[model samples]
Target: TDLNWPEEPIYKEYREAIKAKYQIDRLMKKRPNSRISIFAKIQAAEENLAQSQAGENNSDFDEEIPF
Candidate 1:
């Protein structure tokens, strides 16, 4: 039997980091106060989220596989 348990802390931290990165990216954009700049921030956040999630998923996969 397989159990799907969510790692709340890891997930929460990942989300928070993404949010903060987005905010910082926005502030660094060509027009910091523009709506279009927010899109850039979102893109940056998405990349960061993907990397973080990939790392977490890889660790989980490793834990499940036996050598």
Candidate 2:
């Protein structure tokens, strides 16, 4: 996984997301913003959202829940 990127769309999607996340995390360090931090804060938010929406909740970003 480190040396090669798979041809599947799932791999491509994850790769892009992780790349963007790292880029944003680096940016947040160089230019700190109180409004948002894309690292741990976002992860925490995602967890919270997941728990809160464990019911019949609808979202515009109807992404699949990871395994």
lDDT of each residue in 10-53, candidate 1, tens digit only:
47676667658678556667464677778889999999999999
Writing each residue's lDDT as its tens digit, candidate 2 over 1-67 gives 4446566655657867876867866776667664456676988999998988975475545566654
Clashing pairs in 2: none
Q: Each prediction's TM-score against the native?
A: 0.39, 0.27
Query: Scored by CA lDDT, what does every candidate get?
Result: 0.72, 0.69
Cα shift from native, residue 35, model 1 (Å): 1.8
The C-alpha RMSD of each candidate to the native structure, in angstroms, is 22.9, 19.3
Candidate 1 accuracy as TM-score: 0.39
Best by TM-score: 1
List pairs with backbone clashes in candidate 1: none
